[model samples]
Target: MDNLTHSFVGAVLGQAGLKRTTGLAMPALIIGANLPDVDAACFFWLEGTEHLAFRRGITHGPPALVLLPLILAGILWAFDRWQTRRGTRPEARLPVRFGWLYGLAFIGCLSHPALDWLNVYGIRLLEPFSSQWFYGDTLFIIDPWLWALLIGSVGWSWWREKLGGDQRPIARGAIAVMLAYIGVNGAITWLDNATRGTMTEPYPRAYIAAPLPLTFWRREQIAQLEDGRWISSDWKGSDFGYGYANSDQRQCRLPDLTEARRTNSQLDAFLFWSRAPFASRAADGSVILYDARFYDPRARDRFSVALPDVECVELSAG
Candidate 1:
């Protein structure tokens, strides 16, 4: 999920009364909520598609999950102490309690992975121990409806707070609504997978239900079929497991590229992250690698790599 969603959830949690448990509790919750994304800084030193290989890895795993919040708690605690020392501490600030701060930080940090897993991008929950990716296919990475729910609730709670009214109940209501919405999306995902299962029964190498943005009732479906061909379709958000499949079959001929992954850094990273990979030959006689999930004739450059002197085998339905 995006940082705003995470921060909003944190703020809502605070409004739900978690913030009053300790000094700087709100900050702890909001910051810890986005703390796992510290790994995003890898884009600075990582070249080409290297980020794809590392983005949701170690930082989201168990060890970092336990340590990152503790680190956040310590920093927040020291900042509170420093404010008091400099005579800048607010009168409304609660007394600093290390235990409460740590506990709240833990709560905020735990929300990160849970929300991230509810998307198609996949998250590495057990990294360092085992580099395995998990997906929920429950929601889009950025859903406008979810944004409306979280933002609306937090806004209402903040307004009530300003009027010196209790905002706890409103916040709780918002959280419940979001959870129910997620439950509906989960059911939709399961239905889509079941439909895809029937569609790709013979050789189901991969099938994924990717949520689309803006609307809550639409998804892009991709499946790697038995004959080394990748097929795709879309599902209506309101439909149960039934969708329209494309008649065009995209066949990817697998050539012996055992050496490519070993020697080509870009291809290596792409392969590590791609769930439904295929190869193509570019117009300029370059071998183009693609991930079926993001493939588009007009957007080939986005998730494609052109390797010189290598040719990819391809078969057309026509």
Candidate 2:
């Protein structure tokens, strides 16, 4: 999910119990919600580390989402107990306060991965055992429609609260609407998968279809086993009749270079281990490699680059 969505969810969670509970607790909840993204700082020190940054590893994984909140809640619980002993008399009991704080934070963290999984970009929901990616591809990474609905409803709730109107009803209604939208979208996705299966079954090894981004009126279908390679199709209409298939093979093969001086050496190893390796040589004689471990072959650009100077040196030595 985008940062705005994560922060908005955190803000909503903060507003939920903070306005009703002691106002001081809002910061903790918000911080905890946004903490998973703290790994973004790696971009400053680690050049060519965006793939690791976006992989949703330990910090955004299920273990961190579940355990971090409990650890934070424990600390908050201890602190509250000490404050109470010092005659602070906090409004809520220690357990109740910690529960709300942890619950909100956990939800905020979990929301990031859930929204990310909805996009074409994959997420490693079950990490450690398998880095294999699972993609929902129902929404775009920065879906304007989803943002409009979520932000608009959240803004309306804020407006109602400011006007001294009952905001909970609006918030609850918005939540219901959002849930219903998710359900409707899920059903549409299932129907699309079924239709795509039916369309490709007759051809069998000829065509493959997968859900595209943003709108339900389109899908990305491709041809397989063309000229000993797979070819991708353009986004076709929902009815499956408006796109042309690329006769050119889209799948890439490994280069037959004998040296270990490739630009994306590490990435190539990772890709090969993950079983979706492909190599392409550019006009400048630089090789571009890809790993299907992460969906959206476009992201293959994140790998390290081999300079023309190095390539020339190796060629000259040969």
Candidate 3:
């Protein structure tokens, strides 16, 4: 999920009455929710496809989940003390409680990985312990519908808070609705996975339902056959019994690049992070690498890389 979504979720959680737990609780929640993204700083040093392997890993793992909140709580606690010493503390501000602040921060930090896992980009929940990437395949990376829900809930709750009315109910309602929406989408993905094998002759050896933006009922389907052919299609939930028409099918044979991977750092990182990797030999004799999940001819350069002078033989489908 994007940072805005994470922040809004934190705000919603706080507005749902957690803010009363202690002073600076809202800040702890909102900041902690997005703290796992600290690994994004790797972009400064890591180059080309390397960031993919680095991000959503260690910071989102169990160890960081525990350590990050503790650090954030300490910072907030210090900030409060500093404010008090400077005589700048707000008059109506409630007394800060270290224990409550830590708990809230932990809750917020925990939400980061859980929400991150709900997308197709994948996350390493046990990083440092293991580098395994786990995908939910449940929601699009950026969902406008989800944004709307979170925004509306927070907005409504804020308005009610101004009027001195109980705002928690509306915020809680939004959470319930959001969870239900996610559940429905999960069921849809499960349905696709369960029925995909029987959809046509020669079932796919692997398949994924990549959710699209705005159109929650549809998915960009990617499937690989045992013979190594990759197929892509726009799958609509409305036409369930009738199988989807394949938009494009290509023989994306992956050549043995053990030597190239060792010699090329970018290629090594790309392969390490690529889930459905395939290579196509270019006219210039270079090999263009791509992940089937994000392959789009319109924006080929964005999700693909060209390795010049690397010869990759196109293997025939068995």
Candidate 4:
């Protein structure tokens, strides 16, 4: 999920009464919600596609989840003490309790991975312990509808808070509605997966119900057939049917480049991060790799990487 969503979620959580637990609680929740993303700074040193293999790995794992909040709590606690020493502490501010601050920070940090897992981009929940990636395949990385629901409810809660009215109920209602919406999306993905085999012949080896923008009920279905071809189709819950298969059967002809994968660092990083990998070969025998979940022809360059001078194996779809 995007940082905006995370921030708003933290604010909403605070508005739902967690803000009363301690001083600086709002800041703790909001910052902690986005804390794991501190790994995003890797772009400074990481080259090419290395970020894919690195981000959302260690920082999102178990140890960092516990450690990150502790660090954040300590910093905020120190800042509060500094304010007190300088006689700048607000008269209305509640006393900062380390326990409550740590607890709120932990809650916020936990929300980061949970939301990150809901997208097709995937996350390494057990990174240091196990480099396995987890995907929710439930929502798009950025969803405007989710943004509207969260922003609107938070806005309402903020207005109510300014008017000296009880804002907790509205904030809690927003959370409840958001959860129900996510549940519906999850069910849509579940139903799409459940009914796949019964509806299609030559059942797919595996498939992902990649959510599309705007039309939340529709999925850009990427399925790997038994013969190794990655096929694209659209499935709309409204119609309960899949659109015709894409004409590009050339995806099945992707050549094996085990040797290139072994020798190429960028290619290695790409494969390590790609969940639905497929490839294309240029006439000169160079390979371009793409993940089926994110293969948009209009923006293929952004999501693909090229490996030069690769041998092409004539893989037959038969």
Candidate 5:
């Protein structure tokens, strides 16, 4: 999930009870919720390292989700206890208050990974022992509709509160809507999978379909298949194209196991954990890497490729 979504969820949780239980603790809770992303800072330190981006790494892992808040809570508690011993009366109960604070913070933080799992990118709910990626494949990385629905509902709730109308119902209703959307999308994806199986040889390898620019029109679906091929279709139209070589022409030798381990280790840990990883060398000698993180084959294009110093195409153009 995106940071905005995580923050919004944190804010929602704060509104639910964290704010009432501990006023200033809300910020701590929110930070804890987003703390898993602290690995993002790695980009500054580990430039050039594979997957070293903050999105994949310890901070985003399950271990961090479980332990970071507890660690933070202990530190806050210890600081408050120290202040109390120094004759700060208000600080005496700070440790006790922080217990609730930490609890709320943990919940807010966990929500991030939970939501992320809904997308094609996987999460390591259990890590250390395994790094297999998993995903529900129901939503796009960025879904305008989801953002609109959630933000709109939250905004409406705020408006209702200002007017002295009950707001909890609105918030609850919004959450229900979000859940319903997830369910409907999941069903649609399942149906899409069923449709995919009906195709004959040169099966579609990757695809993405969602509500398009137009509403009445069915969603647009784009796919890449085994051969150097492409297909685009919609609920309303059937269109296809193939321009590249067969699948065999595109095949290449993969990186060795040692290279795989080294590259995977270097990648954003969260991203590595979220996708099926593959490495190959293109005919032009460029490296091609694939992270099944995003279920779509288009994601396969994300792999790096080396460019030749000079080519026949350049000479022809000259």
Candidate 6:
């Protein structure tokens, strides 16, 4: 999920009455909720798909869940003390307790991976211990409807807080509504998976069946057939939104850029991260690599490389 969603969730929690627990409680919650994304700093040094190899991995794993929050709690604790020494602490600020801050930090940090799992981009919750990817396939990475619900409650809570009224009920209601929405989407994913599972037998290679953005009822299913063909369609219930792909671009190559992978470290990272990878040849014979999961005409896919002037295209026989 995006940072705004995470921040909104934290704000909702604070508005739901967690704010009374300690000074800087809201900051602890909001920042800790987005703390797992500290790994985003890797983009400074990492190029291309190196992000996939690292992000949402150990940072979102069980160990980091504990340690990262501890660090955040310690920081907030120090900040509060510093404010006290400077005599600039807010008059209404509650007494800061390390334990309370730690608890909030833990709650906030834990929410990070759980929300991240709600998207098609999977996360490794157990990383370092295991490299497997887990997907919720529930919410889109960004959902305007979700934004409306969260922001609505947050805005209402802010107004009520200023007016000196209990806003917990409203915040709680928003949380409940969001959870119900997630459950509905989960059912949609289950049905979508069941539908795609049946169709995969005809392809029998690799596939990704994930929820699309804008609407939870719709899904985008992309696959590579046993014979090196790519097929994609959007599903709403049992009906396909755009029908099955019949365009020339629908035919995809199961590219084996093994030698190329060996020569280029970035390509190696891309291959490791690509779930439904396929390749096509550019006019200059360079291999244009893509993950079928993210293939769309409107968005630009950048995983292409020069195929070293060799016959690298190989389709599965059986």
**What C-alpha lDDT, on a 0 to 100 scale, does residue 107 get in candidate 4?**
99
Supply the TM-score for candidate 3.
0.91
For model 6, residues 51-170, the per-residue Cα lDDT tens digits are 777888989999999999899989989988888899988888888999999999899998899999998778888999998888887888998889999999999988987899889999
For model 3, what is the alpha-carbon lDDT of residue 184? 89
lDDT (CA) per prediction: 0.79, 0.53, 0.82, 0.82, 0.55, 0.76
Roughly what TM-score does model 4 have, to 2 decimal places? 0.90
Q: Quickly count the clashes in candidate 4.
A: 0
- lDDT per residue as tens, model 4, 194-311: 8872338888887888888878888777788776667667532211111223323133245665776787777788888999887654446555677877665334444667756654
How would you order the candidates by lDDT, starting with the best? 4, 3, 1, 6, 5, 2
Reference-based TM-score, model 2: 0.67
Residue 216 lDDT, candidate 1, scale 0-100: 68
| 1 versus 2: better TM-score goes to | 1
Cα lDDT tens digits, model 5, 1-318, are: 677766766665555445667534656666776777776666566534344233434565777877888877677667666766888647323235766867876887787777777766555555554554456667765677777866777687778878988667776777778778778877877776667634566567776544333141233455555542334554212322112232212323333444444545433442344233433334454544443232232334233322232121110100
**Model 3 spans with C-alpha error above 4 angstroms:** 235-252, 297-302, 312-318
Candidate 6 or 2, higher TM-score? 6
Error of 4 at 45 (Å): 0.7
Cα lDDT tens digits for candidate 1, 52-103? 8898889998898789989999998899889989999999888989999889
Name the best candidate (by TM-score): 3
Task: Name model 2 segments beyond 4 Å from true.
Answer: 13-29, 70-96, 197-216, 222-230, 235-252, 255-265, 268-278, 284-286, 291-318
Model 6: which residue pairs collide?
Answer: none
TM-score of each: 0.90, 0.67, 0.91, 0.90, 0.66, 0.87
Off by over 4 Å in 5: 52-54, 71-96, 201-287, 290-318
- Counting clashing residue pairs in each candidate, in order, gives 1, 0, 0, 0, 13, 0
